[model samples]
Target: MSTADSLAKVIATLDWDGDLGPASLAVDEAEQLRSRLGDGATRWVAGAVEQSLTALHGQIHDSLAPWPIIRTFTRHVLTATLLRLADQDRLPVDTGAIDRDLAEDIVARGIPLSDITQALRSMQREWLSLLIDAALGVRPDGIGVVPALATSVTGTMDAWIGAATDAIVEERRRVYLAEQVRIRSAIELLVTAEPVDVEAVTQLLRIPLIGWHLSCAIGVPPGGTVERRVLDGLVHLFARVVGSERMLRYETSAGTVHLWVTTDRPARTPRVEDLRVPAPLLVGIGEPHPGPDGFRRTFLEASDALRLAGSLGDNGGVSYGDAALAIVLSRDEERARWFVEHELRDLATDSPEMADLRNTLRTFFDTRMRIAPAAERLFLHRNTLINRLDRIQAVLGHGVAERPAETQAALVLAELFTRRPEDPSTGRHEFGA
Candidate 1:
């Protein structure tokens, strides 16, 4: 046969299937070469895996693929490639299952596909070189067959790479879906008042259950979306503020995030003014509380505070301490309104005159009913303040001092429920300011 015909024959007879049975003279010859290599083939695979690992390390600083996983995958690829060459027929390597498993793990770890492909390419080079050297060592006259063997090696490696690409995409979709389900289940369990296995939940969510937790409810404007980078930035900020290394977060479909920063010891509540929240984002923070029960309590508090902030059109952070009364009173809106109207009477109206009277009353209560300080704070003459107080008393048909606690509580509830339009330029409610 001519040289071209001889090359064609070699290529045609080369087995792509991994069958070990004798199919032709070429198969017998290839099998003899593999048998002669013996432990040398094993050594080649090991060497190739090491080389590939080294290459990967140089390129990727943080790959989620563990040492054992990488080694196992590399060995399978090399072993299957070698088997195909020995069989000298079409060797269909079964790397689909392994690829899918590995791809899912890598995707979950957030490792880029480029890193995986780079490692695979490194292994391909090492395996090809080793196989060629082995072939020449066993048969010095096999130089002419080198092209056909190299073609087979490249073809098999390329197929593996294609399969891996598809696996990576599929695995990414699977991981995203699985993660959503896991987070939803965890949130439900943690928020409910039902008895729970704290240990099991901690393991499932991978967060500390018995530490000091400072919960925060972070919200963007309605219909907004929170990107991954934004969430990461928020986590870093919260961790730094609370001096905690551990944190747990869950993002809702409406672009709200519930985050908990945990520490071993008590942590100070982050100051609202110090938060420096940006525009279009509002944050509600719960006080630091300890243990599993505290976790649920703090989360509830933060969520309540967040709703209050949103309703009040607050543009910045609001702590539970700041919104505690509003949150509590707003819980029973009907009862709260009745209490406020009953206590304040005519002063409970949203009229400007009533608002002024309520402010004066609030100032009076704040100053311990000291007329001098209350008058000064309200910027009113002493007699003017006294007259307003008399008017307030007449509206209630009693003395303000007669029901100080109830009057004060009623004033707070009235202020909380008063409907006020948000400032156009500042995006803040008058009460918030």
Candidate 2:
């Protein structure tokens, strides 16, 4: 018989299902390795991944494949490689689904094709080493079949690589189209004032709309750029801070990311300091409210807060509560600007002296117009505090306490709308500095 017929006859005679051939021996050796490792299949696959990664360490840069994904892929490849060795004809290994999944992961993670190919080649080497060693020990003339067995392994790997590459391309296309659809759906659900079918919107967005929602908006300043990985990291951090897992996100082309954390109970506000937000990225969070309307309301609130942060030119988290009054006043920015300029007159000018006076005035209001307390808080002598108050009154030509409500509103608008030079020390723009 020819070599092809001889190889086919040998494969047919082998009891692939029984615990007796080279396949069984290779499996047993792998199991023994697993036993020696003492952490079950995870550790076994991790060993293979380590070897593969080590082989491609300097060859590829910026590998985004997570460890869990690598471990799962390694396990699948190991199983499929051994199975393909024993049953070339009746290859029961249906790795098509897993191959597609792996392809999607690779595309999502930005893992290079070469990295995957190199890893597969490394696995093939390991599998061949184990199987050939077993075959030589079990069969009398196993050396003669080595060439055919090697050929089979190579063919299997080549087919897998081809399939994976095709799947990767398809996944990339799917991801782009899916993103476009999601963006359109999100805009309809969140941006429009018109009512929507809540159930349909929820199903389309894959998020529940019938729970308490705490919304947040995160974005970089204009002319700044952020990566998707950075945004995803921020989302994970925010989820941890809020202690919620049910999160829904909508990312825009402008690099703004809006998300909501939902719960059965009322969501509590997260501590801003605990966020430890990085520089150049601002976060705005809204108060928790219930139901679908609350979801949209909180999203708008968060967006308003984000705008407040941007206007302040500060790279930090801002809660809706922090900017609530300003947001209300700035709704009609033209009128708000007029009110501020009219109320403060020359004090609204971007000047250091005016900023100091505003700070004192804000502190005085915070202390409920108590001179002693305000003076103490400002670390000023009682007479010095009174003198500054007198100066502030001079600028407005009225007593600071005369129109408390209107004065406070104007102060908030001025603080938000006034353009000041950047403070190098704090990396923020002061009210009027």
Candidate 3:
């Protein structure tokens, strides 16, 4: 039997079928073994018995899939096996101390069981050396072609051919796998935006919150510089943890926060949309959809939200959708946008019935607060009003209702943002559908 075969039998001594911890230990042993093998050979061997390693890894790593880990380990094992053969002088001479040092470090850090075992078939550089010594060139029973191979020039040539075959097979296997990684990566990029597109933008954009495995909530704070520092640190860490193109942008206000991240593709360009936002520490609900108008261009919308986050932590920020904000953005760039940002966001626009939310909101301003009355006047039930409010609440999030004043102010801002002149020529922007 080959060394891999012997090891497989030895593995049965560990009872890998039992508990997870023991299985992990078995995996660790496998890793230690591969630490001595070569990376490529390891990969090929793992491929040969992929099913076995899969089962072992599932029993070992438990949470992290055993497949990727085993595959990775297999590569390492092949590398180690190659280095060992070089050491044995059966192959061209090369350094092995570097590998020995690396193995030592891995051992010091306590290598995971997941790092052990798989397709690394224990194919050492001395494959010919061992075969020549044990089975092929010499056999205790008959010495059939053994003695001839050990002595004749043709025998040496044949041995070399076998060695050449092993090396060629490994090289071809590597080429095939490299092509696979490239093709697989391209398909993955089409599905996942981070690595394929606009990944660079997230580097500049900031994220104020993140959690382990997509959980973005920050735990409630007790309030102090310590808490502030901790929370701020968490925010920065969250941004850093996300670290790249997988991130989103956000805007906030006295009553809400909106996200403005775009999608990753060039042709399928993602418009800036609301990102998650809330006071760094305050606990309350915020709207889910884009909030009321604060005239903002795409880039400006994103930038302002990030900037606004620094100044208006307690205030809800960035309430309007890109459509609503885009209107003012086209005309008086700074003034209208600034007014909405600073002065007028919380005035009052008449709230219409839930059904009328799609219509021009400016018409409702005459009532001081038309949302409830309009719903009633429209013969809509109180539940209907609540639902309309709920829809608005879900869209903009519920954070803005900190008090009546904030709610009223947001209402007025909505009206002002929507106000348009009767004559199409009054404002420089040529009004058209």
Candidate 4:
């Protein structure tokens, strides 16, 4: 065969799917090429190729370190490609196997096709440059054959990459849809208030079966977008702060995020002020409790806490610990209102006189209704505190000194009922007192 015909036939050898016998290339043609190149030339080229591949692997590693599966798979495919080329006389290149496995790895790792494409292009460029230089060193006149070699190498690469890219895209879509279904199913099981198979759930979610769990319910303002990476970083941050690994999260159709984090030991759970999260996100963290029952309860607690968070002050995350009583009372609006009116009378109204009385009462109760501590807390003298207490008794028709427990409860209900949803800081003196 003419030189052109021979090179064309060699290129055709790489096009086989699974019919590679012992070698991908024809024996006679391989022998002829080896003879033309000389054995020493083949050894030198293979060694250079190996060193070049190592360097390229390092570069790929740096670029795709975040995706370990893709990084590892790319390295494997490069090594396998080198092996096929080096031993073309005895082994065939099964590009199909490489393509299939690479595609699967990409999908499983959640890597984008664009990233894989970029890596392939980088490898193709490096391989072509190294191979062409090796070819020129072996045969000065071999420059003419470089184009054919390039076409053969790139054609095989393009075929495999194209197929793998398509396969991974389709697989990723399938997995994404399947994952959404799984998330929905898991949520239904959690919120139905029925008995759930906790073991089955733990196995399915790959989370701890029982541990101290804190649930956080996060809601973004309308028109705000929560990217996946941001959410991932936030979850990692929470894990670090809480010191736990058994964490699970779900995003609702309403664009709210629910997270359940489990820890082996329960400490004083951190408040939202302690966590690093977006300012626009409204967060409510539940008290940490143990086991699957704790998991369900904490979720409910966080969800409920989020509702009353706006009235607590600041858009920062609210903890159930601080807002639980207010949240509970606020659930029944009419009852809370009625209780506030009957118990405290006009003290429930928003007015300067009512504010002075509420502040004094709050400080009085917080200080255990002590005459001295209440005076100190209110920054008032003993005589002034006495006067305020008398005025408070006149308004409520009961002396403050008589009903300490009932007085405290009434003060709390008054604060809860009078809380302005738009301005959480309205009753700060009353709350803090």
The candidate maximizing lDDT is 1
How many collisions per candidate? 9, 0, 61, 0
Tens digit per residue, CA lDDT, model 1, 60-99:
6764457666566665666566655555333345436365
| lDDT by residue (tens digit), candidate 3, 76-150 | 433233333223212221222113333333334444423422212222222323323333322233234333323
Tally clashes: model 2.
0
Model 1 stretches with alpha carbons more than 4 Å out: 1-4, 8-142, 161-180, 223-232, 422-433
| Cα RMSD, each candidate | 8.4, 14.4, 20.2, 10.8
Show where candidate 2 strays beyond 4 Å: 1-187, 419-433
- Ranking the candidates on lDDT from highest down gives 1, 2, 4, 3
Model 2, position 22, has a per-residue lDDT of 15
Model 3, global lDDT: 0.33
- Give the per-residue lDDT digits (tens) of candidate 2, residues 1-433: 5555444334333222212211112354455433432233323333444555455454556455554555555555554554455442222234353456666778788777787777678767865664465446544556677787788778777776676666677888889899768656754455454577878777766667777889888878766676767778888898778788988777766667888898888877875566777766888888888877788788788887777677677658678876799877876777988999999898888889999999999999999999999999999999999999999999999998798999999998888776522531111211111
Q: Model 4, range 102-210, lDDT digits (tens) per residue?
A: 5666677676777777767776777667656645654434466578667756765676576666677667777778976875576566665557788877777777748
The lDDT values for all models are 0.70, 0.68, 0.33, 0.64
Order the candidate numbers by TM-score, best to worst.
1, 4, 2, 3
- Residue 322's lDDT within candidate 3 is 29
